[model samples]
Target chain A: MKLKEEIINKLQARGVELSDIAEVAYHLQKPYSKDLKLEDCLVAVKHVLEKREVQYTVLTGIALDILVEEEKVEGALAKIIREDEPLYGVDESLALAIANIYGSVGFTSFGYLDKDKMGIMKELDTTKEQVNTFLDDLVAGVASAASAKIAHQNKNKELDEAEIS
Target chain B: MKLKEEIINKLQARGVELSDIAEVAYHLQKPYSKDLKLEDCLVAVKHVLEKREVQYTVLTGIALDILVEEEKVEGALAKIIREDEPLYGVDESLALAIANIYGSVGFTSFGYLDKDKMGIMKELDTTKEQVNTFLDDLVAGVASAASAKIAHQNKNKELDEAEIS
Candidate 1:
């Protein structure tokens, strides 16, 4: 399968659908965009996923989570990751890379999703059966980037209208 | 020349030295590491420069700055970039990609350096003659990643000491 498909499959296996992430993105952009549709958010999420950096981050995080599940990771790092330790910042850092591609709005959106644990992010965070240390943040990253993309599009539309006037 | 050397040369041509970036990194880490040396920071900066993502970001940002200087970029985007508009968040977003590799500490450090605009970052930000719309944030990103590298090392050292006890 293609890398994007592979990533999607991986997320699906982890109980996260792209639509779930899109819902979060819609939530973030709704206030800013009066007529925004959920479909627009879904398209933005897919566009964000097409990025190589985002794909690599998702694969890497998922692979690590799998390793933890298999008990392959060693020592202190393993324990920290398995427990999703509050202070272990690497997971969030990896996710930040995804959001960073969009803009400052991306960062702010990510910060909010991360802290608020909205939608699928909250579900991932509360799940104890599997290690989701990185997946939770990755979900937030995608949602944040998608939201930023919609915001940028909205801004460009306004600029275009202004120029026409 | 290799990709690494090519990136270094590009920065040198743009009037930024690795040591200048190292100074910012050292400043960020000094409060935490009593024995942190400037050389250590320099080494960390070099290490960050070695990453493909960082190298690509630096080259891309510099290339755009050069394009703006040569009057190649068109329309409102060009004007926004040339003026270094405060609301143009893409520059900082690109830089955040470089910092995201390290961890959450890297994000915080990048935020601080971007805001304070110290050392070479300050010089790049204030140079009215040149379009440094992206270079300033790139500098902050490098310094932040280097600082985070040192911080991670220090944390590992503490963990080792604790385990030994």
Candidate 2:
């Protein structure tokens, strides 16, 4: 069987770049630590991306978005997705399902990130080039997972400092 | 149309009490402000319950959980749900989707509450009276939404205080 990393890499080769996902991680953690590196965020983002469920969410949402961009899918579904109906929230539902894979931390972070639309997310929402139905939540997942990862790692450091002092 | 509070009261008649829901709200806001009341949290919880999507999620999840408890749903899906399969994270997905109505704050709070199982959540999970398959996430959504609500409210309060100074 192919390794999980190899699987994620193949998916990245398709369209979703790991770097774009990593950029969100950079934004989420930069406020806390100036020394934060993209690689650090990439590690956490990749960890979440490696999950089978996340992979499925990423591919499905992007494919639909791509089809909408190309004007392939037609009729009611396309209209809803393209317009992003306020009440018809299944689009957000699918994206949130992907975000939930990382744990509850993904939920609230996904909410704020969705609202604020920062970094690559900012680009995704603003870009006239493509319909990014899944990109925002996918990016939010990466950012939330990375934030949880950093918080978990820092928790121990904080405990150690407390003991020393 | 029935008022939102009335619709919520109907749900309460089904065994899930508003007071129990409000208790979760209290827990969520208490961390931020000791002076926060159960009524304030109830207002926030009620606001979330007003959403059509949130209402649907709560009802569907609880119904399924109840069906399983009564052995009405006898099949593979029942087995999976009753067992809460490791890979079958959709249950949490539906629950988290409800939580997402508020935003990112729900994510982490839901995670912690799901793990720790404190307050009313603890009772629901451990109850022998009925299977609470969905209550965990539902309650978490209540608490998380309330947390996000208080956080949002507090943000404005903080700004007001800053201006006052």
Candidate 3:
């Protein structure tokens, strides 16, 4: 299945807004790429998930369910999660393996943003009334990984220019 | 008093290692022109701290204390904490602050070393002991900031060269 379609199905299963799925996927995908736009990264994530034969929808649904149950994805997302919600754990590392194809930098960014920027935390924080303590570390990870990516990109650019000259 | 000396004293009083004091200060100081050596940054930080009258040592010391008390410092340093502890909470950020004076690339090396190179975390993990989580962020921050400093220094150098030429 197409990654986007897969993500959509997963979100649909999880009772997340059809609109929220794209935004969530985009957040998950963005810190991983500097060369790619947010949409491209999202699309790429979808691609990698499919290539790996991942049940992306199932995995994402489970993750969302856990987040909701644990009050990590509270408010609107929580309201949607039903007793019939799938039973599974999100092997985020597996999902990240798909992103690592882009680079470790992407993986780190994914981890960071996942922890910090997903807005689910904010949603969870206000609605579930839980603290987003994990967010700061996640932000730091993204930043640290991004720094590596930035340096690597700069070095690669230097090499490319050198070759061109 | 010179900023370097002030910072060093504060750090020592706060229980920072003598070895790390100057490097931390170097990382925290303003950019030096062209020179990328630790010494150059140390000198620059000392100079700037003096000029600005900023008590960087005190500031850094407090930050270190917070991170340490939070159990954020890890890896080799964490091992050091378990044995022959020079002090607690003198972390990657302090080290990076020292590096930041030199350039951005310098901190990359530190972060790279902190993650892949440091063997302490593996051992600590196996032992089920808490390794410093904050260290990695500090290292990353130092590298990121240093990269910024290097860019700034490069710009200044180019301007100076252009003016002279």
Top candidate when judged by TM-score against the true structure = 1
For DockQ, the strongest prediction is 1
The CAPRI category of model 1 is: incorrect
The fnat scores of all predictions, in order, read 0.21, 0.03, 0.00
Q: Determine which window of 10 residues in candidate 1 chain B has minimal summed lDDT.
A: B108-117
Q: Candidate 1 at residue A128, lDDT? A: 85
Query: How does the DockQ of candidate 2 come out?
Result: 0.05
Per-model lDDT: 0.86, 0.69, 0.40
Ranking by TM-score: 1, 2, 3
Query: How accurately is candidate 3 docked according to DockQ?
Result: 0.01
Deviation of model 1 at A88, angstroms: 2.3
Off by over 4 Å in 1: A1-87, A90-165
- The residue-by-residue lDDT of candidate 2 on A1-165, one tens digit each, is 545665466446434577877887777667766677889888878787777786677667667777887799989888767765433455556656766554544554565576567767787777666677666666676677766676556656776999999
Q: What is the lDDT of residue A29 in candidate 1?
A: 84
Residue-wise lDDT of candidate 3 within B35-105, one digit each (tens)?
56666544443433442212332233234333334445432332343342422323443445544444555
- TM-score per model (chain B): 0.97, 0.84, 0.37
Query: For model 3, what TM-score does chain A reach?
Result: 0.40
Per-candidate DockQ versus the true complex?
A: 0.13, 0.05, 0.01
TM-score of 2: 0.52
Q: Is candidate 1 or candidate 2 better by DockQ?
A: 1
